[model samples]
Target chain A: MTKPLSPGATIGILGGGQLGRMLSVAASRLGLHVHIYEPAANPPASETADRITTAPYEDHDALTAFAKDCDVITYEFENIPTEALDLLEQHRPIRPCREALRISQDRLTEKGWLADLGLQVAPFADIKDAASLDTALERIGAPAILKTRRFGYDGKGQARINAPEDAADALASLNGAPAILEGFVSFTREISVIAARGLDGRVACFDPGENVHREGILRTTTVPATIPHSLATDAVLMASRILTALDYVGVMGVELFVTDTGLVVNEIAPRVHNSGHWTQNGCQIDQFEQHIRAVAGWPLGDGKRHSDVEMENLIGEDMDRLAQIAAEPGAALHLYGKAETRPGRKMGHVNRLR
Target chain B: MTKPLSPGATIGILGGGQLGRMLSVAASRLGLHVHIYEPAANPPASETADRITTAPYEDHDALTAFAKDCDVITYEFENIPTEALDLLEQHRPIRPCREALRISQDRLTEKGWLADLGLQVAPFADIKDAASLDTALERIGAPAILKTRRFGYDGKGQARINAPEDAADALASLNGAPAILEGFVSFTREISVIAARGLDGRVACFDPGENVHREGILRTTTVPATIPHSLATDAVLMASRILTALDYVGVMGVELFVTDTGLVVNEIAPRVHNSGHWTQNGCQIDQFEQHIRAVAGWPLGDGKRHSDVEMENLIGEDMDRLAQIAAEPGAALHLYGKAETRPGRKMGHVNRLR
Candidate 1:
């Protein structure tokens, strides 16, 4: 059996946003040190981390130095460049290995992997150009999403093709980048299963949380999602299958579309997720701490929820409600120490337990 | 209403140990920065804090600079010297005020304050010298505890005077420090109420927790303490009385002895107490966050416990159980990140929720 990482051991984190900020806080609680590597001058995680390497992901020298100091390298976001991972992996062990990220980084690859596991996904086809888009749209039909295969977040890098004539404009909009056309699925609601898998292959999943999005940014997630019991079970099972297929370690959030027929795989996050934020107030162990434990080779903690909870993200001007949230009797208000509240930026969040 | 402390506002913290570390974590969660002034290098709070000023409590220049940058000053431990408080308060707001610290720092003063509140306390008398010790021993009787009035913690600076002849020797051993001789209370169990008071004079208290001590150090604290409802109510009332009398703005813990007669106040901590650690798992807001909210001039959070919990401190060699503790299914482990764990040092703690 692998020895558990000691408290003073450093965990290297990529992408130092609020997720990294929270991960750093959770790591510190476990007596572990964190080294955050981000391009931003004032990444949220840097405030709480023991060390910060303010360098681009392409900087091999800095990445090497960071990797050499860290006992294990993990990431806050899945969009990290493959070259960065290859460089860091040379010096230290990286959890949720390169294979997992490779499969999860692109829409086509993620859907392909999910289909291979006998899980149902929204119908999709690869599109390279106008001609290919025409052919793909012929197969998937109208009202399909044309999304770039990589580097797209918060609804960026995507367009909708409503007709064959519109397909050409959509292809041109991506600037000739590789893209995929996905058939939209009519879903009753969207839900996600946030779970952790330990080195010993033990998986623990929190109950699925129903999610609502605003402009592709998560607005709120309410736990004990109002889905059929069988559908919830199916969502959790699909998540476990993905974890096992990737041989993944650490927490992975599996977002699913709960349709009238059944659950359809949406995408997988390779780290602690926004949907799981309710665990901070609802469960005994939160996703951040669970992710830390998984990478540390410690046993997985119980992910049982003691209360039904709702987590709301405070974006930009939403932070103005901090005082009102704090005044709420059963609300747990959490504000990240970001110096500025840019439009659409996640300034903080509040978890209310009932 | 007062303006909310902004993101760049600096919070001054005294006694930089694990409690201070957790407090800094909570403060950063609210976008408020912290500057920890501690005597030791690499104090636990320093790892995550924005700045660390390492200097002895007597360093006037360092204290002045620390106070000047902070919007408000608060402490993690109650044992800080009164002179240090006087110096810091000159430049910034000091929550819980100097009067609370003065009454809590000495046993005689604390007892006098409690008695003035019309509260029940063990029969006690002041002892100054051999003659005074002899007189107090006769008044308080044998099998009593003779404790130095100042600077005593975790069984230090005190001796058990089980017989009349031991009084003179015990008094001499303390080198004539002001002392308090008190008859022992035969109690069924020990319990403590951890509560917070906001600047608006609102009080919120968590359910009282039963505590067990070994060698004068807290061993474990279990919530939903096996006590009668009336007894727990009395404990909360006692804590409320103390907070009101002191005009306390931050969290304070009141330890009580449940005896045949009723509840007797054992002692009061002017800062967060170890027994309150269970709230991290059992409540929506832990004591650390509640303390930060109170000192930041924000409203106090809900201090209600959601489940029963047991918290055990990882003192010194007990840290060796990190693996087992981390593996415990429902346990939430918190390590202080201290570099060294000498005998009796509190390395971390674990909370198990039911």
Candidate 2:
């Protein structure tokens, strides 16, 4: 058996946003040091990490140094450039593996992978040019979402097409980037399952969390989601199946759309996700810590919730209510120490246990 | 109202152990930068801090630089020298105030302050030397404990005098350090009240936790501590009174011995204490966040427990049980990321909620 990483082992993290910041904290709590690799100066994770390499993702030399210093490498986001991953993988193991990244990075590839695994996903078709866009629009129709196959987040690089004429403009707006047209589904609510797969292939999943979004940004997630037990079971099973298929290690977030008939896979995050923030206050093992443990080659933690919980994101000016939220009984408030509170920026979050 | 500290404002942290580490995490969550001033390299807090100044406490130049960079200063321990406090006070605001540190550093002074505040304390006497030791022994009697006046923690720098003949040897062992002789109380249990005092004198105290000690090191603390509501109320009142008397800001821990008649003040830690670790899983706002809020000039958070909780320390080889603990239901494991786990070292802890 391969020996698991010890407390002093260094774990290299890619990306330096709030997710990376929380992951660094969790890794530090597990006696594993973190070295953050991000291009931005004063990235959130740098504040709590053992070291930071402020170099561009394409800097192979810096990536080589980061990989050399880390016992294992993990990314906080799925949109990591393939070349960066390829460079790091040559020197160190990357948890969740490149296959998981390849599948999750592209919308079309992700949907195709899920369909191949016998999982239901929204009807989708690739659009390469104006002609293909016309065909896709005819097939998928108006009111469908045309999204770039890669590097789309927080409602960026995606457009809603409401008319046949809007299709040409949407394609033009994307700057001729590769895109996918997805047929819209009438869903009752959105939910996500956060699960981890250990190096030993052990999979542990927390209960599904019902999600609410504002302008495509996650607003809140309530655990013990308002769904049938069988559906929740199916969601967890679906997440486990995906992880097993990819031979994944570390945490992965599986977003699902609750349809009238059943749950359909919406997307997959190859790293920790905002929807699982409730675990920080609601469950015994948070998604961050579970990811750290899994990447460190340790056994997965028990994903148990002691109380019903609701997590509300402190988006932009919503942070002004920190005092009021802090005063609420049984509310756990966590703020990302970002310097500026721009519009739609995720400043922090509060988790309330009921 | 005083304006809350801005995101770019630097927070000066004194002492650099795990408490400071956790406090840095909390502060960073709010976008505040941290500068750690510690005498040792590789301090736990240094791992995540924006900058670290490793110099002796009395080094004026280093201390001046640290104070100048910080908007406010707070400490993780009470053993800071008076000169260091004076130096920092001249440059920036120091939370918990200098009076709190003075009272807490010296056992004699702390007990005297408690008695002056009309708080219950064990019978005590000052022992200067061997001659005075005899007199103190006569007053406090056998089975009394002799502890140095300053710089003692985790049951160090202390010796028990069971008989008159043991007095001289105990006094000799101190090597002429100023000491206090206290009569041992037949206490049934030990508990600690962790409370935070805001700049405006607002006090928030968490539920008292019953602490279990192993070899004078805190092993476990269970919330909803098996105590009567009246006793718990008394503990909170005592903690509030101590904070108010000191005009304290930030979190303070009041260790108490539960007697048949009432509670007696055992010691006062003018910073976060291990007994408060349960807050990470049990309370709305943990001691670290409360401390950060107090120092940041923000309103104090509600210190309310959401669930019954138990915290167990991972000491030495006990860290090996981390995987087992992680797999246990309702267990939240926290490792300190320490490089070594020598005997008597606090490697990390785990919180279990019911």
Candidate 3:
């Protein structure tokens, strides 16, 4: 892994969702071929990847074959099966490392690791059972969120505990899974920094994007987030510190809460995040390509934003208005090739250049 | 034909060279699949295309199957065999239409057609043999080019005549192929306009690019081409006139010779042109996506460019410098995934944003 991969090398991606689809496309831009591994039939990445293995992660043969074909392996989602990653790592190098995955996969591990690094994070308590849940809620406070320590995304696996009376119902939402109570942080806004570290340990960070959420799902991310010059510099510094501490290689999205005192890290995704989608139109190298460059052992791009952009995600039924969005002036539409339009599925996104 | 193609519809592309490879990537961004028809095995487009038919154009069955799967058919090059096009047209709509192909396939027809349209083409003469070549040289004078009427590109299939004595060698170089002698025009610089027309006949044109050639092969294209404001306007108007006249339903590259006399029509390519590669990083809608939008019956983008960019072609051994180029700040590299490097063969391109 000391030398960068040559053109025509194959990158194995685990997960064929929109992020994988985009990662595949970005790999193609660099003359790299992508082989996608996903259990779903005709996943979105299938349309863009050079090859796709539609087999469950539990299938050892498929995972081995995918790893054998790739020079490097990466994943779009952090919660990949530990056994599968264990097998693939034996065949080829898995980027961002298993350490990043182990930490980011669970809220408790990520919070504790960040706190150890002297990075401010939300106050939290781990709860393993009903008795522990009540004790954690009392310590964290009534106005808090009880979330499963693992496999939670887009507001799923969490319930609000507005008061002590609501604790039982919030715990019910977890359905006996181990949870963590995270006390709310009073911040002016949410912002995310898409940062990447190359094999040589050099880190590059895109301008943080101000995020707006609807129903707990990311709705829009605007680049050049409205903030003071010092805070913006602090936000990028915080991301670089994390990338350096983790010895990370690949793009990571660091979600931060902008408080009056300083920036508080809300969460970290070990792969490309929807908040960085504006980079597709605003910068020379995008988050997807940055991730590919990192995993492929290529030199990192100097992440510089050339234009202000606002990226809006097209959630499920938002696709019904595809024609309208396509015809809108200054709209660059990117749609995921999904056959079904369920209520919460991410259909695609559009970046409007300003 | 009136309705725009929906997400997930397939676009059948003829030729799987670098142009087709890029076209496939662009179609994917719009949620469309690409099926490439190529005679060569393991073409560059194979990495990005959803499907590829590795059969020669002579195979009507393969052509038929490809067309049957695609909602619309478009080509990356103009010289597709007539019989193959004839068979594919019966199954699905072929865009840019047969008229554009007919006019651009031969030097004689293109020159005559442009002249007939009252466009300012260079002085030229038709040569069917050595005798005709002699007659044409007498009329057009020395300092002309003798080119094969069909299949000429990248300075191939043509010979230069610096003086009347050079005429015989020029004609001999054609090997009795029907030829045309184009008299040299005294132009300050070469510029090209990338324009597109939708199914409804609406036309949109990107800014003209100034081209620099090395040994008659395009080496670089810089947008915001050095030219008077009025001439730039005139260039777009001229391109719009041609797309309108042919009822063209895809993107076209109109090369113009900018002179003291004004812009002279040099040549026209009926597909995405290499000169338009700058748009990939400069504009919201690039030439490939614009071409896809045209043939797919979607509305054309505004064709606005937000950045000034210079696009350099990676030809032959230029690829050996990949690592150096990849590390350059503000440089966006696009490799065609071509395995072998041959002299004059396009391997990829790099767009540098300014």
User: Among these predicted structures, which one has the highest TM-score?
Assistant: 3
Best by the lDDT measure: 3
Q: TM-score of chain B, candidate 3?
A: 0.99
Q: Report fnat in order of the candidates.
A: 0.83, 0.77, 0.81
Per-model interface RMSD values are 1.3, 2.0, 0.9
TM-score of each: 0.98, 0.97, 0.99
Cα RMSD for candidates in order: 1.5, 1.6, 1.0
Q: Which 10 successive residues of model 2 chain B have the least lDDT summed?
A: B322-331
Model 1 agreement with the true structure over A135-168: per-residue lDDT tens digits: 8888888999999999888888999888778877
lDDT of 1 by residue, B1-354 (tens): 255576668889998898889999989987889899999989999888888899999999999999998899999887897788888887888987788888998899999889999999888998877887788777878899989898888788889998988877788788878889989989999999998999988999999999999998998999999999998998998899899988889999899999999999999999999999998888888898899888888888768788899999999889777777777888888889998888888888888876
Q: After superposition, how far is residue B347 of candidate 1 from its true place, in Å?
A: 1.8
Q: Highest DockQ among the candidates is held by which one?
A: 3
* Residues forming the 10-long window of minimal summed lDDT in candidate 2 chain A: A322-331
Ranking by DockQ: 3, 1, 2
lDDT score for residue B81 of model 2: 85
DockQ (Cα-based) per candidate?
0.78, 0.66, 0.84
